[model samples]
Target: MRPKQLNFPLNPDYGTGATIRRVSLRAQSHRVDAHLLDNFHEMRCSIVHDCSIVTAITGESVRIPTTACPAAVHQLQSLVGLPISTPIRDFYAGGIARHHCTHLLDLAVMAIGHAPRPSTEILYEAEVPDELELPVPMTIWRNGRLVCRWLVRQGAILEPLELRGRPLGTGFAAWASLVFEQDQLEAATILARTWLIAIGRRYRPSQAAGRPARDNPEMLGRCYAYSTGPVETAVMTGEKEAHLHRLQREA
Candidate 1:
């Protein structure tokens, strides 16, 4: 059974480019003991105690499972170099969910299931590219005759790009307000929600009917969820008696 409640906030930008994922679960005799190896450029997968193992051939990205079907072993190594941004859920829905080496895929799913909340990563920062070119002036006409000419996006009248400095990526409302030159009590909601999705699978992982999270509110910027349950001692403490007792009680 899955945890009754999961809290995953966006991991800070530690600036570590290496893609990494980790997960651990415990309940009574139920346990998931697994490991996934992803080195941005290659992947290796293994699971112990269940008698499955995937090991990369020396000096090659190919992984051959020792106890699985040879064909399945051949496919295990194919996961190498998958984009770090690849959606593990989508990978499942795309027919990999029940592959020959299911433990490998399950490990990926478990990592994703324990991942940080998508909503918390909404804040983004952008820098002015060194190649940013000033827009050329464009002529505009009122009624029929030309009334005035102004730099593109009104660059001549607009604040200098550098003068504007780099604003914090947070405060979408403030950004919208600045762009519109007015309070954005309405557009702020739309912008923030749109941003969360543009950054997460919550939107456009597929079509409207295919998204996994259909329960999200129509207006997500203002919505939240909280759930809890009876407690149990943390596993891995070597307290086997307490572990089984609490799991039985929870069950």
Candidate 2:
């Protein structure tokens, strides 16, 4: 039997507070487990790998935006036996992305890369306030240290002259690759993703369960459930778990 979906709130009120997203990755011997938690979703993924190839993969959507979202977990099986030596994005370039859940795929890939390391755990925390009218600081912390801080207004970066005028979406990963060192690049990538995701806080999608994916033009074709084309019919699950205060409490 599939595991039961679990729900618990890190914050009682969803859209009224800061939005926090946390990622945790742990490695031991041949296995690695990764988890992602935010206001809208909670997902877990794990991989068992040999020194060079992945042997097993598992993913679970603990909390999600739509009913059809859970079906994407089965797609993780297709990634078993995949070679870990190559860049993962190369596979996404080949159209493998539209077949799986985006967050789960990212966690599984992170696990594969982490399997060869000594037993360790890495944590990433991101915070984006609900206020976006004037410039606001968006930040990311890696392993408990503040690693990224960018002033954002609307959806574009306004402070840090080098990053000024860059929108938080599309080309962000590519542009960040050219700007940061390896470690900083990874943190910036998380920050960029969370910033865009935080937008949901203002719209409060959790209350609109059962709404069709195709109705949201901006999210269409972005991931598996949304890419189902004209027949796309995934709806919100109406179950939201927020940790919007977790980061602040830890501070």
Candidate 2 RMSD to the correct structure: 6.1
Best by lDDT: 2
Model 1, position 155, has a per-residue lDDT of: 18
Candidate 1 on 122-215: residue-level lDDT in tens?
1111111111245332222212233222232211223334324312223433444445421122222222222222222111212222222213
Q: By summed lDDT, which 10 consecutive residues of candidate 1 come out lowest?
A: 239-248
- Backbone clashes in model 1, listed as residue pairs: none
The lDDT for every candidate, in the order shown, is 0.25, 0.74
Q: In candidate 1, which residue ranges exceed 4 Å CA deviation?
A: 1-74, 109-251
* Residue pairs in collision within model 2: none
Residue-level lDDT of model 2, residues 111-193, one tens digit each, is 77677678999899988887634677888888878898899986779888888998777667556767887568767777877
TM-score of 2: 0.85
